[model samples]
Target: MRPDNEVLIVGAGFGGIGAAIEFASLGIDDVAIVEREDDLGGTWHVNHYPGLAVDIASVTYSYSFEPNPFWSRLFAPGPELKRYAEHVAEKYDLTRRMEFGTSVTGARWDDESGLWTVSTADGATRTCRYLVTATGFLSQPSTPDFPGMDTFTGTVLHTAAWDDSVDLTGRRVAVIGTGATAVQLIPEAAEVAAELTVFQRTPIWVVPKIDFPIPRAVQRLFARIPATQRAVRLVNTSLLEMLMVFGVLHFRQARLGNKAGALLARAHLRAQVSDADLRRRLTPHYDLGCKRPTFSNSYFRAYTRPNVTLETDGIGRIEPDAVVTGDGRRIEIDTLVLATGFDLWDTNFPAFEIVGRDQLSLGAWWRESRFQAYQGITMPRYPNLLSLNSPYSYSGLSYFTTIEGQMRHIGRLFGELRRRGASTFEVTGEANDAFLDEVTDHLADSVFYLGNCAGSHSYYFNHQGEAALLRPNATLTTLRAMDTFPLDDYRFH
Candidate 1:
């Protein structure tokens, strides 16, 4: 197990799995995928909470290479996604190349040898010519530091790390946060809980989800006629891409378009909920596309339930058996669920600390909360290291699509390396700075900055209040930029 490897992939999510397959296809057999969990699906395997599902349509969420013609619903749930990952792994025989329960602690570049020395939690050390970090942006959960959280008599669980054994059949449940996960879980919990109280920090814009069962006949047709399925996927992907362009480049156009979208969403809420006050509270003051828009058919209807209460007052503290609001009001609950989202920008330096050429640590470079990457793949001083779904790589469309594009970009880089007989390659500092300047300038006019969205923290932005996460365009533009193997952009050894 201490043998040298060609490439080391430090995750088993969709991105990591895709990298493994791509590397295998390149005739690189010494590739290894190390997953901390027991299975291949990273987020899907961990977050097994109630009413967990994908927001994107099922067809678009899947990998482009291997299409699944057996999706049961437009929005697939967590279990089905996990099964899909497993099926892909089995089909590609990726399980044999993966080492489960092995967490990457840190990775350091050997300056003399131009190789990465990776360390694992199990005290195993290995060196590889190239290191691929496929750890996803949404992989880590963000659990707020609530005072007296440990002393609470009732159980508390983050939605991403749900404790299923704690039954909520007849319990008084209190859900904290009103993000996408909260909207999805509230409706399901309202059906079984004795009473449900949703604590909202800031109201979110939610649109009606047109989620429906995809009939077996349609699945059969998709299987029989691949052209029809491909056509549907192409149309959906293109529409989303166009919407992203409108959101980023054409602000006036996006604002006008969002007004209609907002009116439709608000009207749907008004029609679903009878309480005028509740409907007003649910209506978002900002534009629809400012924050990540959610889709839920029952979220508005759930607020109308007799046993459910939506509280907009901020939380003060957590009492023994109750939650205290900022206005000195307390609501008692039997269980607490934290639907707070993931830490996208937080630094989780895996045990192997990455040190670049000048003995500079990646942590040190990003200490001021500035994330800089050349095309979100390679760093300026880091040679032979690739990061999938890194900073500025997240797209408005499906993440799977972005990851596929990045994997292809990396694949092309590897081909260029082989053709040139280069042992190591790194982007020049001038090129990296130029790319970052362009990205920051593009983000300045985007909706995340110009929109009149209040109380929204810049998770997508860095410490400098610049958007460092989302990509400007959709699949075609992104892939086109990545398609050109720009060997001139980097310095080779």
Candidate 2:
């Protein structure tokens, strides 16, 4: 682990593997890709809950550069997605260059040597010229400080850390949170558990999912004629872009699109739930697209089941054998399932010291200025360190779109390093300021700020109450910019 390398990639998910492949393509041979898990796949490797599936369509969510011609469905399950990651790893010969079961504890830049001192938990350290963090936004699981959680005698589990061995059959299961994961799991939980109680803090808009298996013949055709698969991907991407235009770009269209979407959701809810009281309880008061909209057909139908119970009073406290709601009802349960979301905006990321120029830790910098980066890639003071999917770097439906932009951006930086015969480069403060200012200018047009999601507790907004997670730009716009973006905005030394 003390071996020095030219580049170090942390987290072997979509971002990390993609970075390694891009770097190698650019003749950057000396690279090391590390994963904390015993295997790769990051989130896909970790979250193994029941009824898990991708919300976004499979074609768009996957890598654009390396297309999977034979996806089982339009939206593949978690294991299939993980298999795709593994497929990419093997295809690109990335497995040979990866260090599994290794966690990066800290990264310190040595100004004199122009190398990043990357420290691992195993008391090992390596100094490399370039550092790339592909540690995903949804990497860390968020479990709230539920009162008396430790005292609970029965099995308690986060959806991210699902225990398959736990006997959900005939057990009274209390599921906490009603976000995307909750919606997906509730259907499955209701089928197995004797009594299923889903605790809802706030209702999220759930719409009908458009999903069906890709026929084996079609898969064969895609495998044989690559153009056919490309056409399918193009159509999927185009459709998603249209949604982006209506929901994320234009104000008037966004408003209309949201209204139509809400109407559709209401119809779907009404169709599924027979009980008027239950339907009313399930209906969301907030505007559509406030939280990340879920795509599920089975979720609403689960509420119609006799075993299922939807609790909207909110949780007051958690006792040893029961959960007390805000309405003072102590619902007894043998098992607890936390479909709680990830720690994206409020996470203590890296959870280790990252010292850059002037001994400035990234933790301290973020504390001062909430997660600002030059095009969400490079920071002002952190030289030769690139974040693959930082704040203000979002694009279309899936993260693969961001990875496509980042790959191009990373290539450009490396190109500059080779062309100018420079050792390192850091983003200029002026450039960082200008980039974010543009983001602010365009923020007013998007649904995040214009319509309603800002008031909602969506992870799209940060702890400072600013919509800092997503960049207000089209996917193509971001991708084209990354192709030959101004390298002069960085100080090459």
Question: Which candidate has the highest lDDT of all?
Answer: 2
Every model's TM-score: 0.96, 0.97
In angstroms, give how far residue 131 of model 1 lies from its true place: 0.7
Question: Looking at candidate 1, what is the lDDT of residue 465?
Answer: 66
Cα deviation at 350, candidate 1, in Å, is 7.7
Provide the lDDT at 428 for model 2: 91
**Minimal lDDT window, size 10, model 1:** 344-353
Please estimate how well model 1 matches the true structure, expressed as its whole-model Cα lDDT. Answer: 0.81
- Write down the TM-score for model 2: 0.97
Q: Candidate 2, residues 245-334: lDDT per residue as tens digits? A: 676666555688768878999999988988899888887776665567789989999988899889988888899999999989999999
- Deviation in angstroms for 62 in model 1? 0.7
